[model samples]
Target: MKKKRPSLQDVANQVGVTKMTISRYLRDTSQVSTALRSKIAIALDKLGYIPNRAPEILSNATSKAIGVLLPSLTNQVFAEVLRGIESVTDSHGYQTMLAHYGYSSEREEFRLASLLSYNIDGLILSERLHTERTLKMIEVAGIPVVEIMDSSSPCIDLAVGFNNHDAAYQITKEILKSGHSKPVYLGARHDERTIIRLQGYEQAMREFGLEPRNICTDRPSSYSLGCELLKEALRRYPDTDSIFCTNDDIAIGAAFECQRQKLRIPNDMAIAGFHGHDIGQSMEPKLTSVLTPREEIGKVAAQRLLARLRGETVTPKILDLGFTLLYGDSI
Candidate 1:
């Protein structure tokens, strides 16, 4: 009732050759004569044969793949970063397998362990924090690994990203310089990057002799969270002159909420966001924010890992790409 799946032996039989010869031809075309190779190719096409790599992978003990772990799949920030990684990997004829841990270290551990079981050649991780078992697994794997998006001390191999603290501090100081002294910091997600940015904001506020007010939540950042954070900030710090958000999602949401409340942007409450998302610029008043080099960090991290894989030396393992302060009407 059903057609049988073609096997390597079927292709070999079709070409009047032994399975071993066909196997050698599949592994390396040079091993077979040109005429025989053409015959094998024709037979494979005729049989609709597919070469399975599982056996080869088992024998070679290398998957010829890169495992990439990201915190969020829907975020454009990570999409851009993935693009940068693929730009390098695709050229090198390497395949990338992606997994999302949803910003959870425990889930990240499980996903990473599963990837390692596949014997991937390398790994690119967006999150810095890892469980002890995750750390041990990586150490045992002893492959080229890279940590992207945020720099951390005692990294596995390479750390590539901008300094979140400095970026937040510089941007906050700019808002203060713009005459918004009573600014509050709003954040969500409570990721390592969020905490670092909050620290920077707090440091800037203290340095300016102003008390820092932070209204934050552990929930993942979103447009709705932005609106809610602003509402809470307004409720508690009624005299808040400005708000520095952890990311553009919240900042843009705050802008929309301000419009609904008939609050004049900047004149009524200055707002700034980080990550420099395109939507932030589309707002009526535009968003003032910090633009971190997310894609560039991904590209550099990939290049570094590839270099190590190729037996090339990688100098200065930790790379600080830095960030830009986008001056706009919101601040």
Candidate 2:
């Protein structure tokens, strides 16, 4: 279990005063004796009681805690983004509460409802489940909601995501530039992000007057799936020279399959991935990938929510966190 955070009651007991006086001091209420204020302030420092400064709009509730609802924490993409979100939130003395719904819409709704029961000031929704009911609930909740990871929809007050089409097109173009006429698209079927990446690959290939047969999306990538898919894709397109996985995990699997078959990384078959997972950098032949601005996106989303909570009427509905190409040994 975690250590208990000292509360105002603790400070009240230690300062030898009623909770009313402590509340007055926290709110900077006048009509308190100077000597008593000093004693209470000292006790506050000694007991380490942090005053929760939430937006005043709630009127009945206040909190410095924000809730994050994502698909899963096992994925390193979420971990890196959380790192960025925490970097800013910790400095501002706010705490983050994480909840994994594993792509279930019902679970997401439940999580959102549960967070409302607490005194949370804001929420970061990484997935885009823009149902009318969800929107209605958010409207009644009287809090800020920021969308992350996907940029296709602006159903919320704020959003943060990169141009999926551009990122994929650039990576695919790199594959073609390296003398690979037919490159394979390796990944799962995502929502709009996946569709954009698919379009990007098709668009790049079509620009070169090539057919759009150079693509294959799959279930979440694993060594087994990578090995199995690589065998079939290579057999079908024997002249294929490169493979671009949607995320780093899939790319890593493809790289491993090439190793098992004694294929040189870029020399034999170029490989790349998205999400820029940390494991890619440490692989035997480092995997080339695109580094999404996970941290910046999280930080920006938080800032937008804060702005909304402060009653700002700014239209920051769309935020583009650009991508960075990581040219590792594989490329």
Query: Model 2: per-residue lDDT, tens digit, 1-331?
Result: 9888897788889988888889888877465789898898799889888775544425665577888888767767787778878887787767888888766677788777787767688889877765566667788977788888866655567778888888888988888887877788765645456667888888988887776654455355565666666777788888877887777877787788898999898988888889787889889788888889887888887777777777887475787778888888786
- CA error at residue 230 for candidate 1, angstroms: 0.4
The CA lDDT at 185 in model 2 is 78
Residue pairs clashing in model 2 are none
Error of 1 at 143 (Å): 1.2
lDDT of 1 by residue, 173-219 (tens): 99999999999999888888899999999999999999999998999
What's the lDDT of the predicted structure labeled candidate 2? 0.77
Instruction: Give the local distance difference test score of model 1.
Output: 0.89
* Residue 275 shift from truth in candidate 1, angstroms: 0.9
Assess each prediction's global lDDT (C-alpha) against the native. 0.89, 0.77
